[model samples]
Target chain A: MTRNVSICAMAQIKNQPAIWQHRFQGMLMECFESIMEQTQVTFDMDTGLRNVVTCSDDVFDARTISDAAVTDVVGAHFRGEEKVAQDGISALGYAMACILSGHDDLILVMGHCKESQSESRNMCTNLSFDPFYSRPLGLDYLNAAAFQARAYMEETGLTDAHLADIVVRSRQNGAHTRHARENEQVTAKEVMASPLVADPIRQMHHYPVTDWAVGFLLCCEERAHEFTDNPVRLTGFGSCMDSYFLGDRDLTAHFALKKACARAYTMAGITDPEKELDLVELNDACAYQLPLWAEGIGITGKARGPKWMEAGGMDKHHVNLSGGMLNGNPLMLGGLARAAYGFTQLQGTAGINQVTGLQRALAHGTTGAAGQHHAVLILEK
Target chain B: MTEKTTAGLVADIFATMESRVIPEGVDGITANYGYIITGPGGGQWTVCVADGRVTVVEDLVTPDVTTTCANDDWIAITLGKLDGMTAFSSGKLKVTGDMGLLVAAAGFFEKYQPPLAEITVADIFATMESRVNPDGVQGITANCGYRITGDNGGEWTVCVADGKVTVLAGIKDPDVTTTCADTDWIAITLGKLDGMTAFSSGKLKVTGNLDILSTAARFFKKYSPPSAGPEEAPEELIVLKQVLSIPQTFATGPVMGHFLNALKEKRILANQCPECQRLQIPPREVCAECVVRCKEFVQIGPEGIISTPDVAYYASPDPLTGETRETPYCSCHFLLDGCKDHETMWHELKASDIPRAERGVRVRPVWNDTLTGSVTDIKYFEIIDD
Candidate 1:
């Protein structure tokens, strides 16, 4: 077996609806300074950090080279830096590969996004589609998720009430999670009463537009102790992208997610993920995804998401105890936030949401419309 | 060796004739195709299609159409390595009898696969050293590794140093390594699936020194399956062109309001940064350099000198109006009279003045008849000769 890569420290600013007062660079500097304070890491070429990986999107940032805007603030001056344009969790995966390849031992991973910066998040997502086909029809993430939600609901018998329950529980859990976006607790009745943004998807079901910045210091397992007493090893990482066209995909089948999970599980030597994983952090950008992704990851049988939700499978699996993405993380940073929370719980630093004996955890992130791309990361203590 | 004999390839092509027939494509078509392959390993065969059913005979008999080509060219055409028309026009392939039957016969069958023996991963690696292009690898020194998985897959390294190339089994100390499924690897090598497309969509994974690995494409000449000619598709690609647009509105904020309001009165205003004392044209709310508020405003340019001029030949559609502006337009940055150094404002010069547009040329704004608080309040800047 090759050497493992350990996340020595992770830091993040509070996720908010909008951080209009400060620029995105200022938001990222807080996380950078916090990671520096926590690990006391430096920019030494031979002994310390040499390479930096950042995750952000060009369309969301409205800048061609978005990473260039934060290179100075992230301390990437005259150093090797690469940007992962997908969800930030891929940065963790990329950093892991760098360490395992013996190219660089220590890496700084940073990601930031302010969904509020754009006039409309839907407009930004709409541009992600091809100009000739999908974009002209105005197919954005929300409407695309509605199509998936309707399909999953019809197949699994998940109802409006079940979606309400998911939303209410997310906020109730988020109340205890610091740095989580401040969402008012709502009753299941209130969630049901919320107006539909798209058919079968209510306004309250989707993650709110949020601003966030997070950083993690990663080092090889051999030198893990040099950075911190508590180190969370990234045992495995895998990502899979499905077809670009929504019509080409069976929306609720979890085609990409299943392949991604299978690859990660094999890498971690996990035969039965349901039996081995201590906790699972799913990037549920919407309420339906909570159960849909749960089924996708094999925590429950196919078409059994509704029954599993009623039976409290979410709590039993200890999934999204940090309120998941539903309580609000920006689009690009959803998985990174999940990984950050998983890192905290494994370190026993999760204040009220902490669970005992967390030895292994799964963090999943998704990108593109209707979950076209999925990444799964396995973290072990 | 798995080099297929032309006779065997022709027999296999006829063997799969019935199954490869498309009922819709062959509907209402009655024809017989006679193939004459000459030279060593050559043979003759006839394909009969009637009432949507296909049958094959050992020899050419009562044929409505006949195609005559060399054994090598016949094999090349079947494997999609050489264009049928190219060979026909070049007299490498000769056709007689009903020519229309050949045109209708094109869509009668599905694409042909040359069988596993025709191409394999092992064959690709074994032939790498011999396929090296001397001119392509000149002065290049790098170690490129491959980890091809699946039933026929194995690891191999290509060491190129001092203009010489060597292929080694198993991965050595590599500067870069490319990992892909054996099937995808073969497709990429055969030009079936694009390598960049495979890499982007995650079908192919590459690690370590991407810059070094990029040169690997040039290190080896194109791979041609044994008994197959150069790789090029027979059909021309179909292209669909379209123009897409969406309506959008931008908020100009208070600082922009201060500047655009002055434009209505035939004047130009720029804001001064209190901290840096730098002026921002079109008036930004904050000074980017000082990162402080710029509250002081000054009237700068109704006229200015061009600092940079770019004459554009390509016409991209305007986002606001969804119209393509005429070509030979000059987009320039102007250093206004009151502004110094890099505080230049960007705008387009009049189309007619494009020939004379140059840096240090004096220009003045041409206002629209009815001014609205927008960037287009000034239609364009015209060159002020002398």
Candidate 2:
């Protein structure tokens, strides 16, 4: 049997708009020390912490080889260190792979993104596109999501009122989530009145730009007891990427998301996700993506998003109880944020957002424009 | 091109109803929208939307809401040339039954696309006289000639004499003549392409009495392309755009510092690994191959043979300056004297020597007049003539 990996401890600084006072290295060091304190882990070559997986993006940091900036803080000096330039959750997945492969027993996964360090978050994301066809059109994550939002709404009859309800509920749930960006509670009316940044995507509908740093202590399942009494077993992990071009995709189809979720489900031996899973955390960068990704995960029937919302499926399924990504988490760290929340809920330390008998949880993360790439992780206590 | 009758225009609007329906606006709704156009070529029609589908009929059916308007006004509203509320307040359009439904119906369709009527250079010249501004030519008298080439191209002259303008076919004793491609001329006249930019870029050429052409912009009002919809205002946001930069200090270790210091005195240096006996140009503290520290330094040549040459055509900005590099410069690796196989030092080959850049070509470093202890001390490598 393949070795099982468990996240023994999770640590993060608070999510904020800028954190202008601290550099990204300073932000990461806090989480690194926190993880070390929480787990009492060490860089023991024989059995403890041999490799580190770091998550960051060069475009956001404005420096090439960004992981080099945080190598010393994460204890990667003169040691094995790898970087996942995608989402932070992928760093966790990579650490899991290293432990499972028997290369190392314990691995440190650290991720940081200072979105405030850049001039415009959209301008940095705009570089993700090819220069010839997409960049000239000024297609960024926001406007590209606008195109998807308009198209998804057309297919599912998702109204503007439905989107407003999502924004209002996210802020309400954000009040209960620790380390979540502290945004003022907004009513549905306020959300509806908010001006559009991109048509069909009101400024209130999308997550705000945020700066954050997170670290996790992941170890082999057999050795996990040494780190913490409460360990969240990461049973399954899967990711999928769709076509690069926006025109090549069916905006409402949720093609990449479905594939990602299916792979995770099969790996975790989850036969019925809607019936088996107790909690879900979706990487909803925008409001419409909540229901769209819900359907993609097979937690709700396809094209039944509007009906599902009307029937209170969001509450029934315990989705995004940590306020989700719409409550403001930085890009490239949304999945890691979801995983952090999942770890909290599993540890029974989620405060007000915790469920009574939370046995299984699904946390998702996405990258690229209009959900072009997706990653799903299944965690169990 | 034949003019479209009002009835045909109304029919075309209904024909495109299915393609333009916003599903969210009509979700779970069953409604019949009727139109009774009154004027020459006026007719009645009905659009039925039910069960998330839409269909159009020639005759009016029992309708939840009926809009009554002249055929021309209906066409104008559909084309977005006239606002529906402005027509309604002016007594040109009347709505009967279900006023609430009419308000909801406003969002049911996307902006309609009238068939494209391409604007040509000939059309721009033909409308120039009608579009002339009286204030612009109040005291100006000049004859401007155009020699438009390429497809749909022709010659024409516009004579502006003291607030009165007349256009004549072909050049006639022109004070200044502008020559350009037909497509470029149309783009310039329609304001899609700036005339000054086109002239500077050689897309447009002006000869004789250059001062007269300076007033050409004031000669006419803005031209509107036929059948073009109004440009929608961009979405508003209080977005903050800032340029954030950090000054950084890089500490070059003793090994790299030694290599750079030698460049100032017109010398080249490479560190040799004790274990592998291999040289590292622009030396690193540790040898990657043997994983050992190197303490030995050897003097190499300021002249070398090009091992590999890569000509870069795409321009990427320099990290330090944030300015794009001039393109088509050759990035090359040179095997300096006393070095063998992949120990080649990387630098740029001179632009003038780019054509001669090839394997085994003998080249020498061209040093800057003021030598700083930097890699740029040797500006670039140029091919040496034996």
Candidate 3:
């Protein structure tokens, strides 16, 4: 009995002027109802059998003991509810694990964040290198990224213009995407001229903290078939955790991401990711991550190798078609939203940002201090 | 030190004064004297009196007792609804000098009962020069109470007043509520829940408010403590206190004595798990993996590589120390030189030549001149030769 798994429906609630408490529970419930109505399927009312999971970290917000609030808003009443307490993409991977465990059929995974409630910038820096060693030197995530970017440029001769192109293209795609905020547009020249937040990486290169609530309804193959005619199957999934502290790993390379991508490609029988995948919704929280991730995931051409972007190879592969974190990052929900965007693309229902005849798409998420943990999921039509 | 003498007198007076009962011949002895108590911040108070007419000064010269609690709480007590004795007993109110004067003045209130109508909220507000502004103070009022959902799906409510914490009906009795210094309460309230930091760093102390201390966390609403003036850093000295019972595990042995003695020598030591060979820093009674007693003591050197480092560009003055921690101190994880694999100690790295210090940079131990077995004996780490 070979069962297939697919994304049946998805919903996202991203409001510019919304508080955390306002959007948490109602947004999830509304998404649940909308998915049911759109798919024309009735969910179990008694058991609440649809497994639910939430992802967040204590250090990220004032709600240090936030699991209580999560359990309440997630409606875990009489259900096997769980919290990842890590990052958003890790929660998605956990939801998929629940399906693999054969415990439930339909699974709803949600991630919500409100960085506006606290001093986010300082807190973000607190998660950087050791306070005694790196902090006194004013070394934050921005500075660390600059170090890695400078190292990459020195080693690979990649220019800041290449990084600007990534921002320009991502924002251009975001302009057409529903997930993007209205009236948000940018150009390569503007991205280049943007104030240097951490030399080589300008202000436009990073994602601003946005408020969002995103949910996805995943089902087993039989159940997915009952909901929609063009069900997008989750062909493969992989994830890896690196050291919690960033100094333990090399900053120049994303080993965890590479390992995760290898696992996903092996599961999906993807020999050449650059050609096999129709689109990619990679974790481009910063602009530099694009080229670095492209090289790491074996998306680089064999002949040109490091100069994949120069060859116009990325034109065929749509990366961060939903503006990415650079456009509108919702902290805990950003990674899951990236996966949802990829799933929509594979289903041929991305709406305004739809890519025609999309068969296979890759979604990736990076978590913890400096992308220490990586998660990759492959979806096929 | 001059303020210390006045603070001592106040403490003595309060300790000996008749709290609830007044003697018949106490009328002539009841006299009001001006008081100016100051702590870290420029906290000052002036109490004025003439011929049975008691008038507290409005201008802030130096506070008689400047505490870390919300000014509204202070006003509430002055208005008579909130009991001052209860606040002091709960560790919310801190007094520094003129204990005798405070006790005598407090005694005057007991001896000659003041009319309730004389003291008003407006008077207290005028003195404090601030009106009640409830912008982000939530969860304590009638509409918003402390909501706690238990592990078994039970709901609980908590109420805090006059420095006392009470669990509402239907809520299970809390495990522990500790009464500590007001500065400690403020630190814990401001989301610094690291118990080790509070205890080992001497930022907190516990007394009668034990039950409230353990459970009733200090939740703050954007309250920043007053800045501290620069002063010479105290020379390293080890102060030995009586060994209290180790928490969690009750293993009886000389391991505790040995660890304490090691601190006296300014040596960083850890208990090695015989079975797993894991080095447990701050020597624990039980190993985290095997859950068995760690009997062997391993002397680890004070140097290692910087595992992780974070730069702090902001400063929050430590209330208890009455000094501001230098901004941009390196908070790094040092893997002790002689420890087994994956064993590291966390400490603040001295910010000298920080530009050269990176993730894999080796660091050496900088011991205090005074050696005691306490954790602070190691002072702060400095960059070392590989």
Candidate 4:
């Protein structure tokens, strides 16, 4: 059986176009203190709260060994800490892994990314591919995602209209949340009229370049009640990686996500995921990804996303109660916001965007082009 | 350089020293500066800096640093027309005494005025086009108009598109318009002025998207006016580009060394994973899947089928060299006979064969005329009929 890791408390900065007043240190200052106050958790050596995991990237931070640049705010108070170096989901996964291994109980996880710091995000993603072959082609996430969107849309008979609807709903949902980056509601017509970023992916389809800092306090079930009366338990999580080359994988289907969610399902003791999971928060980096990944993770049936959309959205199945990635979450915290929102849902603290009678929730994150690496987490009340 | 008043260049130095009442703690070590300028128009003078005060005398004194130079050269150095370090190093100015006190002498003075190097507004505006940073102006299309008010001042416009710049004498419907004085514009053009200081001082006024004006700063390298004076003349007016080459030899590890050695003999090499039975071409030290050492050097392919072909339309500049390659080049991976799935050899394809650069396309290795134990031994791969 997997160990129960409760997300006792969490805090995220108010998502802004650019936090020009403060740098990464200043943004982290309030985020760290806010989490401490929210959880009422203290870093006492006697309590055995020993490690910290920070999520950041060199390209976004524009620094070598980006995590070391913010050690004072993230790890100065801890005895042993390490950086995950991936998205927030990966760091949260590492913290949970530590707890499950019977080594550490309480772990501090912080994630921050300033999208404005990069000259071009697509160029940074281009560097992720192998230098010899893929790197020379100058393919960034937008172009690669365009190919995926076209292929996936063609295969599943999904159109640009379907994508436009997703953005409309995402922005609408974001308006009801407190810390959403894009809150103003946009109509499907407005989304469709937006300028094209790539062939199929429009400007509205893309996540706004945002500055965000989010911190979390994870305590084991043994002392979960000490932090909060109702703690949202992070029951299970699994991360899987597929081929690096885009040409090597079938972009139409989520092959890696299948493996990732399967491992999580086995650990969480979840069978018939469509009926078992109550709420779903997906790392919809683009608008098309919401419905596509929804079907990919078995939240909805294959080729049934369009039908679900036509039948008045995923209301029958609660998903992205706090908007999701289309609402301007930074690249590093793309998945972190999803997991943070999932915790709020499970804790019944998801104010206006809360789903009624919510018991279990699934939060998903993805990295690399066309979701090359996928991570899935099942959180329960 | 600002215009100054004095009877002559030699007397000018003495006059400035007379008024150069020193500040406290300036004269830590007392010294005398003696100047003996010899030329068609030459003279001598002595400057005594002691006890935080400086006094000048027409007669020479027992000095620390006895600075000697030609009258013309000394005048050039004092007027900022010639670089002081260049004059000293090139033996134009000779100093035969304590050189340490020469540096300390600068702090002993209140201020000394240098002669102005005459420059016109036309000369400053003429070089504006050449000073722009081509790379920085790339992909930007805008017209920046300038209006200079004063004698020798006129209207001008700079139209920039991508990396190309066109400067016109008259106005073009501009995005960002700037207004400044002729003196301020010339000073700014000659690097004698700071843009921010000029803006704050109300000498330079800019009206438009202030962002465009700020970006305009990046649109150009520091503008420097040409100096007609022999002392102030730069080595050249036009830029001369050169390739800085540093030869280096990198050590190839045992596995890679073996692979390159095999290439010299016109043979291919692969490393087989004992665990998965899968082979890696361009042989790796360890199998990526099995994570174990693979010492076996098995031959894989002289010919193979293209698995993934990338026909690049853009040429990303090599950051190290800043040189961009010609576009429409084909970089591909070949699925050799022994290797299946994604395990393939990464290499370039012949440009002529780019149309056929696709999956399932058969290709053969095209080796160089003379084989060397290097990765470049195989020039590229060419499409084969069968």
Tens digit of per-residue lDDT, candidate 4, span B1-386:
21222226556656776666667536466778888888655777788777766778777888777889987777676655676657887999888776655655544655557444457777666776877787789888889999988987899998988778889998889898889989888778767898889999999888876777777777777654343343345665543333322232233456677889999998989877788877777765555344345768788888999989997653544657655576568889898777788779999999999877778989999999999898889999999974
Compare candidates 2 and 4 on lDDT and give the better one: 2
Residue range with the least summed lDDT across 10 consecutive positions in model 2 chain A: A20-29
Query: Model 1: per-residue lDDT, tens digit, B84-179?
Result: 767887999998776546656767888887554458899999988888899889999988999999998999999999889999999999999999
Q: Write candidate 3's Cα lDDT for A1-33 as tens digits.
A: 555677777777653423434424444444545
> If you score just chain A, what TM-score does every candidate get?
0.99, 0.99, 0.89, 0.96
Model 3, residue A361: distance off in Å is: 0.9
User: C-alpha displacement of B344 in model 2, angstroms?
Assistant: 29
Q: Who is ahead in DockQ, 1 or 3?
A: 1
Estimated TM-score per prediction? 0.56, 0.53, 0.50, 0.51
Which candidate would rank higher by lDDT, 2 or 3?
2
For residue A66, give model 4's deviation from the true position in Å.
0.9
TM-score: which candidate is best?
1
lDDT of each: 0.87, 0.87, 0.61, 0.78
DockQ of 4: 0.02
> What is the docking quality class of candidate 2?
incorrect
Kindly report which residue pairs in candidate 2 clash with one another: none
Instruction: Tell how far residue B292 is off in model 2, in angstroms.
Output: 26
Q: After superposition, how far is residue A220 of candidate 2 from its true place, in Å?
A: 0.6
TM-score of chain B of each: 0.38, 0.40, 0.34, 0.37
Candidate 3 positional error at B209, Å = 68
